[model samples]
Target chain A: MSKVALLLGSLRRPGNGIGIASWLHPVLREGLNDTSSGTAHTGVDVVFVDPTKPPLPLGPIVDGSHVPADIRDPSKHPNPNVREFATFVTSCNGIVVLSPEYNRGYPGELKNTFDHLYWEWHKKPVLLVTYGSSGGANCSALLRSFLGGPLKMQVAEKAVAIKLPKSHSNGSDKAPTQGPAPDWLEQYRPEVLAAVAEFKDLISQQSSS
Target chain B: MSKVALLLGSLRRPGNGIGIASWLHPVLREGLNDTSSGTAHTGVDVVFVDPTKPPLPLGPIVDGSHVPADIRDPSKHPNPNVREFATFVTSCNGIVVLSPEYNRGYPGELKNTFDHLYWEWHKKPVLLVTYGSSGGANCSALLRSFLGGPLKMQVAEKAVAIKLPKSHSNGSDKAPTQGPAPDWLEQYRPEVLAAVAEFKDLISQQSSS
Candidate 1:
């Protein structure tokens, strides 16, 4: 089975990012599980990684020889969280990041996690799903630049951005009440589902090739 | 006198961001101090605000009734740091953000600071000075979007970006020794100085109007 990691980049629990991801999760599963589809894969495994639950420590400076040896060695890292997170990234064949636009950018927690490891993310097929005031286009653009430039990841061009209605509350204490998604999100659902399916196929083809 | 805040967005002290800011500080002061120029302004006062020190707590949710009264009041907040920071922001006539690019974005500390308050940032003029591997264009772009969109601040078109050589070290402990800036930075100095002067003029014009 192909293992895909769904990385939640929001620090708040009851956030739009998570709300959207909650909806996307099943869509991705169903897309991957459908054997009627012409892909050679039987089923795909999805793992949820929340940056807030097991917070990643700030990473070392990106200097070459100057980076502390312990940080360079994931096994020897002083922080167990970093080690566990690294292991999770290494296990995943593909990665999808669901991020909320905070201050018109991706949350710091997400960037911190990516900064922790370099090679672990290399060559991984990645998809971005974002929702916020401006539909998180800024966050998606920055993520694409980072993933393509420094992290050396293969990023999909077809990303999904849902412009959250002004009424949405991104509070930490409560999850958005589960219900049919808002009308704005509903309009994009088909495109988002297609993107997720295409991302899965891309991951399968890349891994098999 | 016009009060301007120099907000440094890096978590690491004695790092490249601070180093670049150190170089830019005098340039800004000189521009602001040169009263002989035609702008209708007195001397300018510059205050340094570091995001890491007296760190700001995550901001309260923007819900109308849910926002804590203390956070809304700014005076009753339990954390003196947040209160002080709010005051500093409110007192400033204009703001300049000096940030280092980390993971192809601005540091979490900077975003956290911005997240803590809303109205204080509104109507302020923000100039970005960034230094990093990609010259912090990504960070600057995201910051501009945030400041312009939700924050309701005016961002200058001409900003400064310094691309540090690969040989530079951004470790936390040691300050880069005082010396003439690298040749690449030297080449950009004139343009950066011009941008700073233009930013000061813009702030003066806006405040006066």
Candidate 2:
């Protein structure tokens, strides 16, 4: 049984990032549940780490009252939040990241989260579900480079991108009634699933070895 | 009169990004103030675009919020703050961008700002001053690619990058500060001055053309 953690990176609650993830979670759950093993993917646990959460007072950084010493070189910094996040990632077999496209890149909170803990991210299997004007493709691509190069993470090549062109608004939709997701997403779902499955298998094999 | 806008991207006021910019402003002012050649980069103006201003009305997609219609494409979506920023950038002759690196990438707000405006940014001359853990080198490269591909901006090849390692917080009497800048920025004065001068030339040429 492998456990995967889904990290949602965005300040807005009903953002496209979370909305699309909401839609995908059921599919992933159903896929894992229907597996031949008969056992469900209960192992797949998700914890949404919101950046706006109030911090525990370890020092100045957490309180936002003053600059934290750990921020200077976050990779080596020893902060409680960083430790907690790293522990969660290290415990999980895989990760699913959902983030918005800010400016031309990933949101600051996401970067701040990762910056504080680099070692935990090494060699982890991660998938990105990104959305925005350009489907956040540039942001995802830039993020992939950063993770692959410095953080040393094995980022899945097939990212799930929800560009605005495809989004249709439905009054019932969790996302701003944004219309339906694009047809390509449905068409390519199998590929993305297969990739995740393979990645899980690889992680399991490594664990056994 | 060429009006050059310095769009400060970082949220930290007294942080490295603004401090570096402040140090270089005098040099630019000197060049702009030169009386002999009225063409010495006059009509200088600096405006700091705050990233935390407010949410934009993202047209129909954003529901009640005021997102501009042109932000349909993710690549075209300016930062949420850009709805106001576009007006300033379009009216200016050139732009000097001050950015900080987070997790080996541009701060989310900085990227968000660019995501909002589309056509207003085309053909603008951008002088990059990126500072971070490793002097923001990787971020600088990624930014160049982004601006070149989508924004269609003339990104100056010569950028001023201040590696965090080189920063000097304490001024020693033995080693007096050399450049026109204050003591803290003595280490990075050369690159800083060079970038500003180069930016002045780029803007002057573009404004005349």
Candidate 3:
């Protein structure tokens, strides 16, 4: 089984970034073209990396006779979550970054996560799935150069951008107050499906070779 | 005096971004070519916008017979700092953004401040002064598009990039731990002066017209 990491870039809850990913997670798991749904997107497991998840307990890992001793091993990170986060990335066959372009740039938390680990990123295939008012065009372009050039990662050609409409008009230009449009998921289904398929294909080739 | 906003993007204190800005602040105040040292930069007032400043006190504005009643005015923002920040931006004739490329992007706090106020940014001349290993090339490019396009702000032609030498060799690609080379300020002095001169010229025209 090929495991893929779905990294959440934005912290906005019920926003378009997470909303779109939630909508497509189950759909992609059943396989895009398979008319009869089977278990998991053709044996591909996606690990959702959300930073909001409660941090690991401060105490030592629970000891058990059945547990592997190395399960408690956390590389060398001062923060347990950061150590686990990096370790989890090593297990993934591919990665899909769900980032929302904020102020024509990507989020800081996303960069914070990427900076924690280095060697695990080399030659790993990454698919950019971004959402924003401009469909995250600038965000995707910058990420492409950074991932492909500096990190030497295999960035997928099928980069997806889910553009959300401008619906907020409260006279202030902060964040959008409301959630996404009612049918945003239905409208962007095809794009999401296509991007996920490309990611699966890349990892599949990696495993086979 | 033509007021300019120097917005600091990165929080690193001894780092290049702030170090370069600190070096140029006084030099610009004295004017580049003038032999006589002046108190201000050719009638241009540069405001340093750092997010780490203490927040405005919760109490009401100090009441005094001699003081203006509205001096304690903070617009409509729930966060007092944000309100004061936006209010202050409106008074500036031009802006200088001091940013560093983090993981190939920019600091989140910078974007958070920009997103807070929209109308204040319209037609405001902005000079991008960025520091990174790539001399903030990608960061400057992205900000140029962002400020010129959506924000509808005036972007300076001479964007300054104080490229720092890659000295952090602790095997982590995260952030440059050490400060810039001892002579980095002297090395990048000419470029920063040129950019600030261009910014001064733009704001001079704004005040004259």
Candidate 4:
């Protein structure tokens, strides 16, 4: 089965980034097969890589390379999360980063996870879905540069940036809450669909080749 | 006494960021008074805010605002480190962030400390000294926007980006190592001095006013 890692990049529990992703998860899952004309997406499963659930450590390597070089592969790494995470990353066909612009850029927690990780992202297509004060425009540019330049990932040309108006926001990017999809999801559904359509096409190409 | 908080923003103990700060500390301390033409800087003390030393938490409020609102003042916060840290931030004349660029951005541990902070950085003059493969330019721009935007801080006109050559870097920003200064210190001393001169003048004005 083809898999896409939906990365939640907000440090906050109920952050708008998570909220948007929460709303879009089902749509993406159901919509993957909805495309009648585009590249055939077969079993394109959308999986979440939420930072808070197990909470990826603040640093790249948990023990900072205390593990012997021989044992540093995916299975034997000292940290269970990193071990599992590396394997999970390689198993995926594509990625979707749902992030919030903290300050003027993306959250460090998100960037921290990708540090020291070189090959896991190789040739994988990425779709950035950002939410913040500036609709996450500034963050989108920086993340694109970093991911494409060093991580060697292919970022989809189309992306979504949801600028939550101050009046509507409850403020914090909280952990995923249980409820119906957030209200704003309907407004941006079309843009997200476009981005995901582009994303799936890229993923389809990667899988075949 | 004019105090400047020299922030070591790298997670690695002997990281390049710490190395540069260590080399620059004594120079900045002694040279703060070396100025003859610019604003008078007296007793300019350069203090190190090394993340690994005490290791600021991976967050702003240690309890994440678990404490009641009334006791949230700098003096009464539940977390001793944060209480003291907030007070320390307020006591400073200016701030110097000595950071290494990680994947085109600043470290999250450093940014996490300032997440909900508002008053501490108000009108504070900040000089960013960045070290990275890109000579720290990309990280510099993102940080400048963040500090100048939500944090309400002033980014100094003169900043330094020391791009350590890959051949020279031991491949990581390790914690500040013991012993004689690293060899590259001498090469960058003059540029370092110029940046500090501008930094000290800003501090001097902030102190005098």
Candidate 5:
């Protein structure tokens, strides 16, 4: 089974990140469970990583000292959170980042998390999932540049963008209670499933090679 | 006299943002005073705006509600910070942004401040000044898009970048006590002065036209 990490980029209680994640999580699970068609496949394992509960203090990362001589060397790093996060990333076969577009870019918190670990992210396949009024096109572009340029991660071509409606209430204090997926989101369900399948295939191919 | 606002994008103590700002501020002042070059120029008034001491709470801006019915109308907005910042932006004949590169992009706080007001930024000529390992090329590109796209601000072609040395120490607690500019920074001094002159010329043309 290929392990996939779903990194949520926002911390707001009723933010669009949670709302989209709530919908994406189930759809992804259903995709993993479906094995009746075509070749038999191992189901995927999914884990959620939230940027709000940062694994390590962002000072070192922001100051550009988070990377050491040997990225996997625990002795060089004292932060347990960084070690744990590094372990999680290295173990994962692929990653899916769900981020809200903030001022035409991804949250700094999310970038901080990525900056904390360097070599652990190299060669891992990543899928970008963004939500916003402009469908997060700009933030997704920026994220792709960072992933491809600095991190050297294998970024998937097919990404998912959930465009929130103009009237969508964001930043409300209430936790997003599970409800029927909106029609707008329902239309994008197939695309999300396709992205998951592609991610799985890419990871499997990389593992075998 | 033309009023120019200098927006500092970094909050880190003894960071590159302050270092570049200190250099640019005086250069800009000298440019404003030097009218003997050719055309008799009006004296320039420079004001420093730090994102660390934000005039308003960032909630409304992050949620994308900072745009008022009439972007120039302060009566429609309830946030006092927005109104105060709006006044500052509108009063300025031009703006100069000095930002430090963080994670291959501009700081979130700087983006948050821009999101807080809309029309106040329209048509205002802007010059980008960035400093970092890669001379903040990526952050400057992103900032240009922001200035040209949503804010509808006029961006100058001439920009200044102060490339920090690899051995430079950032985030030091020691106050950036006045000292001679480092050798690397000294090389970029002429470039900074040229950018300031270009910015003054752009703003002057905009005012007359």
Candidate 6:
């Protein structure tokens, strides 16, 4: 059984990015669940690391947990929240991030989450789900470079973005109320499945290696 | 007189980035103070924005003082931290950001600070002051792209980085004693100064045009 972490970046309620993630969660879960019948067994357990609280810390781990000391002491920390988030990420095999494009990049809070845990983030597989007024295309593209270049995270190619303004409904129901899944979800379902499969395989290989 | 807003990315105490800004503050002040003679007046003021408290709310303002709806019903309003920070940035002629690298990008929290407000960040002139293991090279470069492409910020080419491990010290002092600003600063200072001057001229021209 494999465990997958779902890290939500937005702290706002009724957030467009989170709403999109909610729609896609079942798809990822279903994809993971269906993989078991194949030669490999795939099971994903999702964990959401909330950003409202303090994040993991950097440097040596003092407590019994692999958690850093700064997370426990934010006053002396550059970004305790990011460190704690990194600790959470370290515990997971793979991650799916619900990123919101703000000012044309991943939110500052999300960046802070990574800044605190540089080494722990290396080699992790990340699937980004983004949404913005511009469908977050530019944000997701630039993010690919950062995650791939510096963090050394293996970001899955088949990602999803909910193009805002065009996709959003002006009616009372601003949320995705189109039911089971939107047409766009169906269109990208194959890539999403393939990415998750690759992630599971990578995790399994690393575990054995 | 030129007013430079020093927006310190990391709000932590005794942070090296902050310390560097502190060290440089006097030099800039002296430069400005000393030039206030003969024919012209030269003065510089640097203000730092602290992201620790409740920020002002977003929305249209009638007199640049209050948001009517929020004043009437604070409970119905979204968080205002982003709006307030944007407001501060919009008021400034130029900005100096003391950014620390996180996962090869700016801290998410700091980024979120801007995400919360798009209108205020559209045409601002921003300068980078970053540090990290790689002297925050990748992060700074990526940040420049995001600022220029999405946020539409005029990013100053002149930047600073404090490479780690090599710069690490065993001294008991809380703040790490960093060597002199990287030589890159000298190379980019004129470029950045020109960008700032040009941005200011452009903005003034637009308003008067």
lDDT, each prediction: 0.69, 0.58, 0.61, 0.69, 0.70, 0.56
Q: For candidate 3, what is the recovered fraction of reference interface contacts?
A: 0.12
Deviation (Å) of B165 in candidate 1: 3.5
By summed lDDT, the worst window of 10 consecutive residues in model 6 chain B runs over: B59-68
Judged by whole-model lDDT over C-alpha atoms, candidate 2 comes out at 0.58
* DockQ versus reference, model 3: 0.11
lDDT of 4 by residue, A51-72 (tens): 7665244353234433222243
Model 2: how far residue A90 lies from native, Å: 6.4
Fraction of native Cα contacts reproduced by each candidate: 0.26, 0.21, 0.12, 0.23, 0.09, 0.48
Each candidate's TM vs. the true structure?
0.78, 0.69, 0.72, 0.85, 0.76, 0.72
The lDDT leader among the candidates is 5
Local accuracy of candidate 2 as per-residue lDDT tens digits, B1-209: 56666665565433555556665566555655554443465557655444444332221122213233334343343344444456566777777777766556765455545655667777888888776657778778878877766788888878877655443221111112234555445676666566666666777778778
DockQ values of all predictions: 0.27, 0.23, 0.11, 0.34, 0.19, 0.35
Check candidate 3 and list the clashing pairs: A29-A41
Error of 5 at B14 (Å): 4.9
lDDT of 5 by residue, A71-182 (tens): 5654345567777777777788888899877667776657756766777878888989888877888889999998877788889888988777776533222224488877
Indicate which candidate wins on DockQ: 6
Better of 1 and 4 by lDDT: 4
Error of model 2, residue A140, in angstroms: 3.7
Per residue, candidate 3 scores C-alpha lDDT tens digits across B1-209 of 56676777765444455556666566555453332431224556666665566331112211111112113343755556656766787788888888876556555455545655566777787888787777878778877877788688888798878767666211122233344435654676667677666766666566566
Q: What's every prediction's RMSD, in angstroms? A: 4.7, 6.6, 9.1, 3.9, 4.9, 6.8
lDDT of 6 by residue, B1-209 (tens): 45667665555444455555655455444433443331222555666554444342221111212222123232322445444555566566566666666555776555554444444555666767676657777668877887777667767555656554433322223333355654533343443444344444443443344
Candidate 2: how many backbone clashes?
Answer: 28
Candidate 5, after superposition: displacement of residue B56 in Å? 8.1
lDDT of 1 by residue, A78-161 (tens): 446666777777778889888876666766667756766777777888988887767888889888988877788888778988
TM-score (second chain) of model 5 = 0.87
**Residue A157, candidate 4: alpha-carbon lDDT:** 91
True contacts kept of 6: 0.48
> What is the fnat of model 1 with respect to the true interface contacts?
0.26
Error of 1 at A162 (Å): 3.3
Assess the local accuracy of residue A8 in candidate 1 as a C-alpha lDDT between 0 and 100: 79
